[model samples]
Target chain A: MKPIIKIQNLSKRYRLGGNGGARYATLRESLSGMMRAPLAILGRKGRASRPELWALKDINLEIMPGEVIGIIGSNGAGKSTLLKVISRVTEPTEGRVELYGRIGSLLEVGTGFHPELTGRENVYLNGAILGMKKEEIERKFNDIVRFAEVERFLDTPIKRYSSGMYVRLAFAVAAHLEPDVLLVDEVLSVGDMAFQKKCLQKISQMRSHSNAILIVSHNMIAVRAICEKVILLSQGQLAAAGRADEIVPLYEKLMLENVKTETVADEREEGMGIIRVKSVRLVNRAGTEARAFDTGESMKVVVEYEARQRAVSVVAYAAIRRPDGFICMGTSTRLEGVVLPPLEGPGVVELEISELLVIPGYYIMDVTFYDENFEFRTYFLGRKQISFQINSSLPSLDDKYGVFYQKHKWNIDDVNVNSPAHR
Target chain B: MGLTSNENVSALEPAVTKQTATITEASPIRHTSYQVPDNPLVVIAPTKSWVALNLGDLLTYRELLYFLIWRDVKVRYKQTALGAAWAIIQPLFTMLIFTLFFGRLAGISSEGIPYPIFAYAGLLPWTFFSNAISNGSSSLIGDSRLITKVYFPRMVIPIAAVGAGLVDFVIAFIILVGLMAYYGIGLSLNILMLPVLVLLLTLLATGVAMWMSALNLKYRDVRYALPFLIQLWMFASPIIYPASLVPERWKWALALNPLTGIIEGFRASLLGYRNFDWKTLTISAVITLIILIYSAYTFRRMEKGFADIV
Candidate 1:
């Protein structure tokens, strides 16, 4: 079988500095520089150094046609660099690659779109970037519009579309393009659940049609569900490969150990400021081994603080940061009906987050103890950013992919109920 | 640290974890991984290439080029206070300035035509070329978000900028014709030379825009210096004064600016005046083509670094 993709030893390097000053140069300066050009080339330190960081080095790889592979790695693992080289978005410093057929890449959403242009206009525009002709775009126009599900807004300028809408539309156009090979980055991480599922199904459909796909994703679940093989990149080189089941665990373990070994927030805020929240372990009413909080479970965020002040009528606030740098939930004792008592030295405060409406995902908590008048406060009262995770089986499993997971029960209706089973 | 459920992806059965199972079977996930080809795949290569004219492939991507041009045109005046009228307003206002300052105040000759008409004529191609060069050159940096992410011809940016100025040029040309009618000047048959001038302006703009666009990707200082450079270039050309007034001895030297000849030729073509100096026009045309070709070569050489350094 003819290998559809190949990468030999590839490298990329860059020179830093030299981005200032005016463009004035007299003929004398020019002549002198021209004269010194040969001498400058011979100077030892004048060397830019193949300064030699190979984004990819000796990375000779071959893949059979129609085989889906997951390129997985931690950040700076050269995954994107490899993708960049393979996609021909950036040329390799060394090595050559040959493709028997046309290739389309979805490395970013709205890659070549003019935001002022309408979706219909951008479809033809972006299609042309993928090397499709006008007739080819027109033939697939309806399919593209239908798949993106922005048919009603097709005439509207894409700038008005939400980032989610942009990705969906862009990905839909890429999917319908029908290139022999597709390179997709973590673009599916956008959009709601149903849309993501639609994309996954569409990708599978593409596979059935014999279009090879390479995906880079941190979502191991998605990788396991779709990828036939997994190659893990570590520090610009292949760390592990061959199987997803084997490689993913090692990757996860590696990440988990990194998480435990380093308190990232502590390191980030070390010199900034430091105050302390003595304790943060939350507890329920029963307190009978309540390891996790359920949706609607009455919970207490126990905060004990040691402030460096008299702390009169002290106020305390807690906030949750979602993994994607979004604020999930936050509230202060002042916002609630609590006027804190004056604090002379140390204090313990129990704030009830009435109904934990958050869904399953990693959440980090930041606490601050302040004076009642909201005077200047130290960072996190010293404890820094503590971490937590939320899980709600019903909403997390069904509703959507955002921070909140509100409790709303549903009644099921079976079309075949009268046909016997449920009846 | 306790979220070990993800461990199922690596270890099959926990019972065999201590035994360290040598996983033989590849992961059953059905993803198709494309090989990165023996030669770099032409996947995200900018649709535009400056290496060779690549006009065949360009013709193939004509719709993209068309839409990009159209997009730039729309975006230019999308929410402007005067909308499409700004096109006419920009060149018309500049012509007024040149007429007042250079013609009226400084006492410059118009080669026997009305000052406004001759100045406007000079401003037409000059504005088109300058605007094209100015905007086209900085276009790559202006849309760094787009350039860094997607793989489209980087040349399209400067090309679009130049293309967008054509709309303004057309609008300004309409005004020029109306002015010509008002001034009672007859159209010379030499107007046949107008198309060639326009093409020359485009090639020159695209070429210089290529250099600026590519350079601007790395050094944004070019953007700041561009307007000043254009101001100096305006004086260097014959936009306000007649090129003939630059002194017969210095005319050959002044013609080196390229736009001087193109602008003079444009003015002479539309107005019933002196037939354009074929020698100066020929010299300017060749120089414009050379600068264009050379800048394009330099731009091509510089373009590969755009994604990385840009």
Candidate 2:
């Protein structure tokens, strides 16, 4: 049997050195670039002067029909560009794709829906965009409406819908597309948990009809659950590809490696410096690979460094960032009016941010080495940002069935209006 | 639709290997094999003039454009007080204003036709042009989500914007014809030119709309300036007065507006105006042709960037 989709020597190169495309290009520059296009096509290697960056390079792939493939990568890994080229959203710099049949894509939730349009109108519009005919859309209209659970609000303008409802209705149209090929990008991050689960089930069911599914995501669990095969991209090249479980750990390791190498500190670790911050790692009580923490549980962050000289009045601080990039909180020993004596030799310092009462989402630890005056001996040093997720075994009283576990207290009591005893 | 995997590709096309590994090597793997394959498909569209559209493909997608147009129409009137009635109301009220200002107040001649009927004829095409231009200017930005996320004919956007306005044009046209009957003006043989004028207006509006829409994607300030430009453009056309009011030499320049011929031709057909000024109408036709070609070319040039920048 032939593969349903075939790609050969696919590559997408984007130039960042040139202005960010915000400014118009000068005629001379444009002409020069056009003139040099032939030389660049000849594949001349750069000699440490003129350079180029390949957003994707030498990507070759084939997918047999009915296969579900997951694309995983860190930021700037050419995952989106690859999908764009396949979906023909953007042309690849150099490549070819042989598509077997009609293509349907949901690169994002609510991709083609107009906000001013009613849910019913946007359904038809978005369905047509996915290559469905009017009669076909009408045939699935009720099923789509039911799946989205927006029958009551179908005639309401989409602008009035919540983001989740907008996503659901838009996704319902895509789910009913019934195309031979489906492309979904990392837009699963948009919808609520139950809807995402519903979407996943639909995708799995859609896959059984010989529909090829290509999913791009940063979420590991979703890929592991749905995709039989996985691909990993690293710095515009194919890094790894295999079964889901195998590729995910490799991608994680690659990300961790990138973090370690790119994490350079402004201040030195030692080298005649009064005090220096070195390495930072998040560890559980047992000191294993752990990012999740429970409320009231002791969590340790080891900030290791070498002391260059005998120092006094040294302080340490850690700032926590929520997954949304907001700084949840930060505190320091200096703020507490306490300073530690200096060490004469190299020493590893560990700061325990114990009893970490925070929400159950990804959080980053930012370590700072400072003097008693809050002047930075070293600012944001030593593995500056390390992420840790909070995992709770049991939810608090208020949100026992919620998506995330949060600590709270509540009480339930029958209200008695006559509690005053008829006074 | 993306199969961005190499191992699967390797399973399909095995790379060439020349060197043989030593027997001690595990699995006796080859020494070296490194080669990058060229893209197999090339764009070889015909360079011939007037590439015949694949009507089959267009027909297959007709339902899409139809749904798109319908969707636009529905969304336009979904929450209105009078709904589709507003479509007729807008042009009627505008015709009244044009009659008050350009007809009754200014004493402008309407080729001896009723002022309401004369203004209605001009307002019909003008509304289409103005509405198409304004909506078309920001159509790409308004549908950035669609452009960035999927692949379709980007032309569908401006085309849909134009098509949806036809709903309003037809509605207002019925009212115009009703007023014509009320004014005791019978239809003339020149009315056969209505379809031709409609085609020209569609092409002309589409052409300019494509240009403005594409440019608006890059420079969003175009979106802000579009309404003001449309209002200014309305005055520049012959909707307020006849083209005969302008001098002959400058009248040549006025024909360059493109809408001059369409509007004057519209009124000339229905009112049976004798001095239809075929020479200026022909010049306007030529100008519209040029604008159409130029706008399509500009739109194609901007098409590649729409998915990225939008």
Candidate 3:
């Protein structure tokens, strides 16, 4: 099948300084500029000497029907710029994009919603702004209201609604857009957990219609859940593009590398040369250092530190965080009521887990050493210093829905079963 | 399974190999037998020259235009104590002030008609024109959120603002009708020219509004300069005075102001004071068309930069 969307040699350039970079030029400056160089004003060539930054450069890709692609990048990586170019909200500076059928872009929810208008009115208004015909909105009006779950207050002005209801109504209208190609930018990060889940379900349902969907988001879990293909962008260039499982991990590593450089500056200023963490290692049950582990396997974290002074009443803290900034597990010596001996020289601290239940993905460990009372001063602080991966050999354990996998047993009518009979 | 092998190969080589492998793998599945649908193909590229005014898109998005106009009319009177009454009150109170200052006190000639009715007739269209342009000039900046988030004909926003002014014009027309009855001035055959004159006024207002709105997006000086420009414009037109007051030597120049013909045409047709000045009306119509076409082109030229600058 032919690709639904094709982008060829696309690039976008933005000027850096002077009046050229200003969002809007004042008439005074423009008049003076014209006076200074009358010929330049006519030719519009005065800005050629200014420094320029390319938001996107030579990005070439094709998207087929029935495909959901994820665009993952750090901030200012030109993810949103590419979406804007495709949506035609802004003209490209070079190259072009060819699109088949109708296109809908949700760069933001509630694009044209008014505060004084009621929910019903805003639905029609916002739908029109999103390029939906009036008949189309009328046809799906009930489903939109049902999905939003705001039937009781449909007549009330949306300004009177709670923030959660407003977001649901806004996202509801956006979700009902039936275009051949859809561009979404971090719109899933709205509303409560249940509403977010409902939105994800609605988006996943769009795939069955064979529509091409492009999602640019910072939420790794959502991208991993719904996107079949993923592309990584760095500094306005395509870095990698492949299956979601492979590219998402590579994107996370790139993110970690960026974080490592930024934290290196902070470490030098705060280390104070008193004591610091020299190394952190993750080991398996066999006592060999390893970076990968299976679900329900025993794991150990060893922290080796050097102390320049005799430090007493020191508390050790460690936290395991997912790539999306969710803390999966946290532990501390103070919370466990363990006391450590005074350290005047290099020593090692070990944290052992009998069984690690985290779901299969990448994880980061943060270790810190605080003085007594867990305040005042820190001997060592390592943020995102040690990274590891958890794998699941069992196909049944390959779910990405939750943070941890709980151990459980199943029985039917008091009879033990290896798996559920329903399966 | 394909990803696993590709990963192993990438691990041995460099990162560039992974990109090529993914592209090559995805490119081989093209099906030549697949039939492409008849959907419209849109090309987005950098605009280099003058873009054609794709008025067909205006026809396609007519419903959005209606909704935008409806929203403006609905939200304009919200939270106000007087509601839609403010529409009639604006022109009514302006007429009263002019009657006091320019008619009763200054004894300005109203072409042998009652000063109040003649001034009210001119104020009806004048108020609409001023309101439309002042509001329309700021419409694009006011709807900046929509401009950046979606792709629609940018012309709809200013047109909607101008369209919403008609509702107020109709409401104020009722007062003119009541005043015409009190003066015992019956409708004449020339009344047929009323619709034509109003269309000319609308076209002229829409043109100026579109031009100013597009300029306002780039310079922002239009916003501050607009109200002052309107104030001076009212004095230049024949709103408070009759066109006959201008000496005959400068009557041709006075007709150059597009509102001069419309306002004079409104008073002459509605009051049966004189025959329609076809010469002035013809000039007004021609100038209105010129401004409309010129402004439409200027609007299209500036539209490509709105989403970026706004």
Best by the TM-score measure: 3
Candidate closer to the true structure by TM-score (higher is better), 2 or 3: 3
Task: Specify the CAPRI tier of model 2.
Answer: incorrect
Judge the docking of candidate 1 as incorrect, acceptable, medium or high: incorrect
RMSD of 2: 16.1
What's the C-alpha lDDT at position A296 in model 3?
A: 82
Cα error of candidate 3 at position A393, Å: 27
| lDDT at residue A409 of model 3 (Cα atoms) | 68
After superposition, candidate 3 runs with Cα above 4 Å error: A17-22, A39-45, A264-423, B1-35, B38-40
Winner by lDDT: 3
Model 1, C-alpha of B93: deviation from truth (Å): 2.0
Task: Rank by lDDT, highest first.
Answer: 3, 2, 1
What TM-score does chain A of each model score against the native chain A?
0.63, 0.62, 0.65
Better candidate by TM-score, 1 or 2: 1
- TM-score for each prediction? 0.74, 0.69, 0.77
Which has the greatest DockQ?
3
lDDT of 3 by residue, A1-423 (tens): 677888899999876657645778778977987786777767778767657889999999998875679999998989999999899888889998988767888889778989899999999999988988899999979878877889999999887776677888899898878788889999887654577787786776554332678999988888888887998988889989989889987887777566545432222123544557777788898989887888788889898888788777777778877656556898889889999887778989999988888887677777767665322223233222566778786666543457787776677898976622112
lDDT of candidate 1 over A1-423, digit per residue (tens): 567776556555444333243333234444765687787788843455424455666666776666678888888788888777776667666666666556778787667777788889889878876667788889878778877879899999887776567777888888776677778788767564577777776665565444467899877767877776788888778888876777776886676555545553331222112335666756765764243565556667777666555556556777776533345677777878678766656667776766667665455666666444322222123434566545554443422454465555444574322211111
lDDT of 3 at A320: 78
Candidate 2 A-chain TM? 0.62
